[model samples]
Target: MPTQTRRSPPDGYYRTTVSSLAIALSAPAVAQETTGPDDGEVRAEQIADERRENPVDSIIVVGGRIDPYRIAGSADLIDSEDLRRFDYGDVNRVLRQVPGINTQEEDGFGLFPNIGLRGSPVERSSNITLMEDGVLIAPAPYAAPAAYYFPAIGRMQAVEVTKGAAAIRYGPRTIGGAVNLRSTDIPADGLAGYAFGQYGSRDYYQGQAWVGGDTDYVGALLETYQQGSDGFKTIDGLPDADTGFERQDYRGRLAVHTAPDAPVEARLEFVYGRSDLEANETYLGLADTDFAAEPYRRYAASQRDAFSGEHDQYRVTGSLAFSDGTRITATLYRNDFARSWSKLQDIDFDGDGSFDSISSVFVNPEDNAGALSILRGADSFEGAVRIRNNNRVYRSEGAQISLERPFEMGGARHNLAVSVRYHEDEEDRLQNEEFYSQIGGDLVFERQTDLGQQANREAKAKAIAFYIEDRIEIGALTLTPGLRYEGIDLTRLDYAGSDPDRSNGPTRVRQTNIDQWLPGLGATYELGDAILLAGVSRGFSPPGPGNPDARAEESWNYEAGVRYRSDKVQVSAIGFYNDYSNLLGNCTQSVGCSVGDIGDQFNGGAVTVKGLELSAAVEPRLSNSVSFPLSLAYTFTDAEFDSSFDSEFFGDVNEGDDLPYIARHQLYVEAGVNMGRAAATVGANYVSELRDNPGSGAVAENERIDDRIVFDIAGSYALTDKFSLFARVDNVLDNQYAVSRRPFGLRPGVPRRIVGGARVSF
Candidate 1:
């Protein structure tokens, strides 16, 4: 008999090892051979080799390579190989290849992504859980989930997305799903490092470098990524001004671990990161007529608009594994973020003591000719153009622990895990306004107001969560059942603008408490080279610090799918439906909401969203040294309201009105040819028309974003074992289309861009 090794059970959320039953059930086409006394050692060595090849996968959401096929729900992983093919810095472009995801483009650079999973709302990506290295990365996920800051994608090693029952394991916002970004990891043994640089159109440049090594008892890593562009949009009357942005990110990691053969294996790690960004961007967009004539032109009123931000993160993690197949992990993390955006907020060109939002001016330009003329720099105006300095600071800190154990009973194997977390976050706002006058097509400073004149408030939240999950295996069938509880306390304090110091105490204070229980179940059955999966889960998204009567978004989600995999081909098709009992909408400046309405939540009554996701991939050998690889993904969604209601954020609402900003159809396709040393790929993405407001029937001309199809091509060639050259062309056809119509006027998509780069490894 073989020296049977006691293999630890797979984690409920992350890293796991392949089981013999899974191998036998999923890969029936492969031949199985009898094992000798050394088979256990050989299996352990194979697992070690796989980890060496992709260390970053250990901290991702979908676990190891084989877990995607074995999990009883929909999951996808974009490994380093896939990311290197296109070298996309914009997350929007990277996520388009994955099914069941919806993205709304803003700024054309993905600086602030609006991503939705399945049929959840896509506003600032607040309806989903976002993480980096298995930890929450949102600045203030509970107090202010709106993503004003996003990690740099150029430095990431992998991206994972999980939906259905598995998503409940990582929550606060489980209505949509969870997206986790994996960063560079310390080498297992020898020293390793890589450097990359790229230069492209519009004076754009990107560079990344990292180095890491592990000794007998210690490991360390350091990395940096930098990118900038001169921008493509031209500012009216200011041709020399650069409407570009610059970003810099830095990270450092240290790890301490016991010997590989220690009785109680343990590891402790510390990580720190910092990032800064400066951009001459704005929320003011062009009028309809101006957009038709010149889509990439910026209005004169927005010439002085700019944004600056800084973020810092610190984290510590510890893991312990016992010889009895039980594992425990704990983590502590903190994040700090601050930003200030100066842009046009309101206009009163006639000096009538009444101010109108910038969005309203563009909606009725004919009626506001005086304001429109001043905005276009065609006429001089006195002091009445208000430019707001929206300054805010955020802080988030949390601690969590998880334990997993496996046992056998009644001829069945069971994996059980429990987790607990305590988190606190806050958002502080201290903003003011500055008056400007238009003189000779140039902005002239008129007057500046004291701090806190515009807004002075703080919102905070403290929450505790508990989760438990069990995975039971019987023959070729696997079942997963999970339950979670969340208790949250929210509070908001408002100060009078006149008393910036708050010496007289807060003018008003509001507080609320909420408790919820979420449950989910998933099952998977294996049948001869194919697997069938189904799941039903409760979805939830908590409301921010708003009206006491505000209700959290609640829904029941159901999904069923089938997957087939062979040596040369893999295919999957899943159908999902989300039934909402109480849908919620949030107002923010990015959505064209007025200053007074910002941070407000509204009830949307009943709603229903149903969608189908299809994906396929195939690779065929054409010759002895050549192969062709191809993949396609498509999604169809129907999202609409089932009851009549009215809200300031969504305007007038009626039954059957479709939700805004979500397209009806999306498709992506890619094909590549790979030789021994050279490779090339071409990809295309298509999105159907989108509506800007809630309404049924034919979309109004002003509220519609026409359908668009964009093509991209990339090629790479290896010159040596450690060096390679690559080039990419985005928007190969230069198709012009409107990406969005919000916060002001029309915004255009990225034009044709060409880039060339090189990479070196050591």
Candidate 2:
């Protein structure tokens, strides 16, 4: 199956809130529970020695970051310690070490990430299910899951990525996988608190503070985190404008245990986040000559662009455990958001309606010299520039219930999980376009040529999903069989653009409903302390609402892997093949989709994605108080179109054409040392060149992003039992390279930056 709470609070919340509920409901079952910088991750990493087992192959305790050996698929648990080690402001930097996941950096600040997993389209991470706690976090996940507003990773306790058969239990739209961001839970025992502050290059500032404790009956927590920067890029001749962003987050939580050992637990949480950006960003790539001269240069056209938005989330969760080994959990949640990005879209050389493509002017300077000169204000020109206001509102709400019960059958032990969810989400587009006359590098807003509304429509989805999985263990071998069912309803309403206010200039309404059942099976065999496993599953992604020509993305996926662990080292390797019957692509504003077709879906009939993932980690004792820890991860992805087709974005494609923007190779490694209360670490991230268009044409070279390796280092020393000083340097070598060629031109990674901070706890 590829596809919520209380009073039906707001939009898209239904699509992202269920994932949040799953984590909270299972809190009690995971015995490694604690309160710290990142409560959930801390709990998993520091399970009182007595309960600690081989992290690689142990299932002694269940938690947010599930162990690799405890499942029939792949799962990675990134903890607070990892975050503390590097202290990267952008989550993308931290995820580079994770195998199988791909990152496409946009703003360098990680404000809006373009990510993909297992060869799925990474345009905007719409193929994956994102959750906080265990519920969905995407705005309008059903109608549109572009992830324009991602969870604030800076405050998450831990981030969990899960794939394979087990993921069926958490989706109505499951093709790639699921990611859960755990939050700081209310303490259960002590009155604890922590505060941290940091400063760095480009006037970057950051702060995070939280306080929480538990009493005999109730627990509560209050937290706040905020950050801002002056930005790294500089515009030619526009020295007064700052290309930076400011983000703020606040969260509150309360929990009631009922009686000390009451068999039942409940918790409620509220989160609010805000972001304001004055970014000099655009979708106009520079000519090779211009890029070679200065890749960080911003176009004069994008100087007035800005992106701003806010999000609010609310959820209530409860868990019940029976004496007979039966457990049940229920969660209700809501999430709502509204955002607008006014950006330069196109330019007209004359007062006529005809317009020249921005790509032509930017990519072929010699051919379009006149246009380039006019655009850069190096020459006088009379033309009009179109600035589009990409505005949208989203809402999602849902409720989910999970039940686990153990039973004995045929001399084998069986653990069963049954889950059901009801979800609904909607997206409303209300956008405007303002026309401006440019002369001598100056812009004059003209209302006479205004396009009142670019987006005047609504799309919505409602779904019911049910899943069942049974894990049977017979001696040294285990087998798991799972099934998921999804029933979905989709609808769309459109108004003529001429009627800017949507006041009825010709209305069009459409709807589509679908049902699907997904099945998967997996098995594992143990050889001493090592494990070997394999699985096959049906993967699917829903078609967009009211798209008559779009088909659901469906695939038959197969995977196999191995894992081994010792007291000092751990290793895991996996290979996956996704044979697709159809591939679907969703249009998103960030990727330059016109506001009129922002949520449209396109089809790439047949495709295949295959890849390998490898990970290794070691901890060696140098001496009693000195030890070195090392980790390495690598991924090889081969994604291509299986049949010939034509696309407006990709131009033309042939059989076996490589998918755009997906690197064929990625690697990351880190090594560190610890001496009692002091620790240090250094790491490197590498990605091979990738193309922006599918076909291998002459322009391919210019479209491919340059390959590069980035290095970072970090260290920390304890000043006292409850205080510590930390320092880090990102891009330590300061080697500049292209990270993205979209929205256009080469966007470079953050330059060399050094930051220092101190953390205090009580």
Candidate 3:
């Protein structure tokens, strides 16, 4: 094993007293242990220990799973051990274990995850703050918060979620809380590395590797991950067509630091990452009857649908710590993303010029018999099927600086943090459409429109944000009060569809300016092995560039919870209420919006979302050589609109209409058996029925997504000190369930999958 030199804690006074609480309130943390070599585990353990002894080292919410009892608000950590047990590449599957989280799956895999926290809406995951290594990771978070490009979860080391007042420290969107993805870290000692490979059902395969080394003054790291699958869905009349996807990611890091004992220790690091994805995916779904007969079948018209994307990220971070207990950190980052998704948009059965949306056809199949026949490849159509290339490019760049200081005042220990950031982001859209005819179950190209004929626009935003938070401790009580301010300027430029080069200037220009202040307060009291926590926070979600008159989504969020921990058991329960003064919705193609209506925003009056979250974990030894570990998480939610409204996106709403796509109840359970070097685990998740549209009371047959339950199992055994073998079966019951009914028709969840892999370390 390699040896490491320990660095002194940031502040000796706080280290011996309330460092854990201070760290939890201030910064991001490495909150999980590694499942690699012995050295990797040791390094992870050391980092956790260091966090407990250093107040300024952590910069985000939530510390580690080992110390959730110390958190002052609702938070959770999905550590490495939990991730290794299932080896899931889909973020949707991993997040099911966390309470108070909801997901609407798309594309079977997690390619375009629709995530919601607390009571926020789950549309493209646009209502929450998303980050990686404490830096904002969403493409064009301000100009276009829709998450068309999400980080590859398989390359991450840990996942962290924070809610309520604890989440006030980060944002542009604070209503739904925040999610942070922690990437691999540079080794703390000599050379260290690990490699993992897996192959599974449906011709699926994945490979990942990382290597890193650290010296007294310098460190470097490199990592790569690749995955592919010949999807589980089959298209009509196309036996050889692949409904699969391929993805690749590469990252590199370099760092330089001063000597361990220097008066003012400092470190500077740089990171670069690139990723590419190509998927044969579509936004087409099936009719109710067709879905029941073949849940994993693709329509003949969607056989040519495809999506491709590329992303590049660059970041530089620097931090300095003074001997007198002051620390400052700064980061500069940039990201570029581009994607093109070509799919069927509409069809015209008659010779008339008017066209009908694909969703309309599915809703009233009898009225669109001719169009249905064309889609099923049972009849010939002439230039009726329209396919659009939804092309867009996004860029985000920002600089942030934060300072932390610990002090004592009025007989109370206090840790204060202040941060400021300047950010700019833009989204450019240049799209076109093509006509195709189906004859003899094959599509023939008719004519292609000029580039930019479908859409030609650019949205830009520049924002400045400042926030200050202070954590004060007296006796067994800790209180944190924070305030945040954001000022943003948004602009949208639209060009005529016939002018791709913009020689005649923009046809329309819109500008909007917004400023808001958010405040939060949290309190926690420790009593024996149990802690009581409560918080109240202001929630805000900025409007996109397309809507200059649209009001930002604002709410008042409140929560109270209790946590208890013993030697072998841990439990927590939280109750939360979010009162939305203004609920906002964005129209996108994924939500069954027409091409012309995409990017529009709708306002829904008053709304209320109340929920309860409960989680428990226990580990018991059955005998000298056997141990059983079990965990459970459950959530119950009640959400409804307080006022009636009408819009293109929300259809017709009543005063008591419930929010769509949000399950009333969700539960997850897991159990594991461990015997020395061998372990096996099983997990199950349950979701209650959901609505496809806003309504109350009884659900209509056409607007319901039935309840579902899924099970998964995994086992692992150590062959040697440096080698381990693992295998897993997902959806063991082989149940076919409807996951969503949007963008056209009914969609199915992932089918049964089996995967086996091995791990090697040095």
| TM-score of each candidate structure, all chains considered together | 0.92, 0.89, 0.92
Q: Highest lDDT, which number? A: 3
- Tens digits of per-residue lDDT, candidate 1, 1-762, equal 112112222233221111322332332112112223254334334434443354342433323453644477888888889899999889999999889999999887778899999878887888889998888888899888988888988899888888877788889998789998888888787799999998999988888999999887899999999988998898889998899899999999999988766777688999999999999998878878888899899989888899999999999999876544456789999999999999888888767867767787777777877778878875445777889999999999999887765554455555666777889999988899998888888889999899998889888998877777767778889998988877777887888888888787777777766677899998998887788999999999888885665689999999998988888889999999999998888788888876344787777878999999999999899897799999999999999999887676667899999998888999999999999889999999999999999999999888888999999999999999899999999899987778888788889998898999999999
Candidate 2 residue runs with Cα over 4 Å from true position: 1-65, 263-281, 378-383, 448-452, 498-506, 593-596, 696-699
Task: Go through the candidates in order and give each one's C-alpha lDDT.
Answer: 0.83, 0.74, 0.84
Off by over 4 Å in 1: 1-63
**Model 3 weakest lDDT span, ten residues long:** 1-10
Q: Clashing residue pairs in candidate 3, if any?
A: 27-58, 27-59, 27-60, 28-59, 28-60
Candidate 2: worst-modelled 10 consecutive residues by lDDT? 52-61
lDDT measured at residue 478 in model 2 versus the true structure, 0 to 100: 85
